[model samples]
Target chain A: MVNEVIDINEAVRAYIAQIEGLRAEIGRLDATIATLRQSLATLKSLKTLGEGKTVLVPVGSIAQVEMKVEKMDKVVVSVGQNISAELEYEEALKYIEDEIKKLLTFRLVLEQAIAELYAKIEDLIAEAQQTSEEEKAEEEENEEKAE
Target chain B: MELPPQIQAQLMQLQQLQQQLQMILMQKQSVETELKECKKALEELEKSSSDEVYKLVGGLFVKRKKEDVKKELEEKVETLELRVKTLEKQEEKLQSRLKELQEKIQKMIPTAQ
Candidate 1:
């Protein structure tokens, strides 16, 4: 009986450790989400900048040099593997929106996987508890018989 | 070990869950790091106002027009934003599930005196 309890205890400890690991992942994801949101906001602000507008551009360090935007309608967009193309402003925006949609789809798949894992964890915890309680009851019955 | 079949099955399930969780966490970490780098690069691009911008392609920086670079950065940022939202949703779902499991475990196990 003692050995059985110990075995269950060890399993419980392992389960808890895994749960903690998942928690740590969630924390990291939260931080990443914050950074991504900030980046999005910064990008949106760029839309307000007009063509031929004078702005301070940063060099290698913190220092900035004044520069003028020649054309805002056309932008060179990176397709992948170091290849880029000259595209109209609207076309470039559409390309990015499509990429975002793809990411959203990927994220949905990930979320589904996480949900499935959570369900499995719940089932395991419930099973462990049931096993533990049964063992406890058996132990009590054995003690009563001895008495 | 002479364990009941039910207990053995439960143990096996727990082990499987542990492995799955580890794999998922590894993937999550990689995605998070990639998003971080993308955000940093976008920030640097935003700070620079020069008409000429350099993009790193295949381990080499190629000079490109500033407008093009900005558009690329904006698209990257937007894509990352959607990704981050999805991650947040997953986090919330996991958190609630964890809480439920903890409560169930507490009920099953006797507290240490």
Candidate 2:
């Protein structure tokens, strides 16, 4: 009986560990989603700029240089694997939107998995408690008989 | 209660298994991320209407033929897919071993009233 309780406790620990891992994964996804949203907003605003407009383009993240917007309709977007594709403003917007959608769906799945694991942990704790209680009652009854 | 030496050994083994599993999982995640990027790039390449595409090479964007870039990305995706599968298999085996060791140790524990 004691062994069973110990095993249940161990199982609960494992479940909790898994939940922590999932939470970290979700945190990363959240950060990525935030970045994607910011990019989407920036792209939208950039699309509104008139042709030949002067804009300050950041150089090395610290200094910015005034640059002329040669073409407002086209932008180069990273397509992954270090490759960049020149895309129209509207196409780039759609790409970001699709990425955000995919990440949100993945986040939802992780959340659901965490919820299920929490339920399992609760059940395991209850089982351990009930087993311990039964053992205590049995000991008390035995003592009474002896008296 | 003192744990038997056998149970102690199993517990140590369980800990090792857990560490190995964690390492494998991290590796899988990184590879999966790369794979996702590769797939996305391929999709974008297919949809791209531009005549020129550039691949970043050591801090510089080197122009490459679209077909060549597509081929490279496709190969990378295939390799990553295989790697992820292998890591997944290792993860599954380690998990089952961990569970078995836990059960064995649990059985060895002396029952208390």
Candidate 3:
């Protein structure tokens, strides 16, 4: 019985550890999602720029260089895998929106996995309680018979 | 009472297996991320209107043919897919082994009652 209790405790400990790790992963995903959303918003705001519009480009956090917007209809964006492509403004918006959608879907999957782990933990706790209660009842019965 | 040597050894082995599983999970996550990036790049490449694309090589943008970049990304995606599959198999195996060891230890220990 003692070993059984120990085993249950160990299982609970392991579950808790896993939950912690998963929670950390979810936190990272949330951060990434937030960053992507911010980028999306920023890109949308760029629509205000007109062709040949003068703007200040920040240089290494020290000085800003004045530059003319040669074209506002298209922008260069880093798609991924160290590759950048020239995409029209509308296309860039679509790309960012797609990324956000994918991340949201991934986050939902993680949330579901966490819920399943929580359910398993609850079941284990209930089993541990039942085991201990049965042991206690048996002990009390033995004591009464001896008396 | 002290735990028997056999049980102690099993517990140690279980701990090591748990660590290995955690490592595998981390690797799987990283690989999956890379795969996602590759897929995203491919999608963008297909949708792009430009005849030529720029690939970042050693902090420099080297202009390349669109087909060449697309082929490179496709190969990367294939390799990453294989890695993810192998890691998943290892994870499944380790999980089952852990469960078996736990059950074995539970059965080996005599019930106090």
Candidate with maximal TM-score: 2
Candidate 3 stretches greater than 4 Å from native: A52-68, B1-40, B74-113
Native-referenced DockQ of model 3: 0.65
Give me the iRMSD of candidate 3, please.
0.8
**By descending lDDT, how would the candidates be arranged?**
2, 3, 1
DockQ category of candidate 3: medium
Docking class of 2: medium
TM-score of chain B of each: 0.64, 0.91, 0.93
What is the C-alpha lDDT profile of model 2 across A4-33, one tens digit per residue?
977997899999999999999999999999
Task: Give the per-residue Cα lDDT of candidate 2 at A103.
Answer: 98
Number of backbone collisions per candidate: 4, 0, 1
Write down the worst ten-residue block by lDDT for model 1 chain A.
Answer: A77-86
Superior by TM-score: candidate 1 or candidate 3: 3
Task: Encode model 1's per-residue lDDT on A15-95: one tens digit a residue.
Answer: 666666666666665565555455445445555776667888788798999988767666565554243555566666665
lDDT: which is higher, 1 or 2? Answer: 2
TM-score of each: 0.47, 0.71, 0.68
Which ranking of candidates, highest TM-score first?
2, 3, 1
Give interface RMSD for all predictions: 9.1, 0.9, 0.8
CA lDDT of each prediction against the hidden true structure: 0.62, 0.89, 0.87
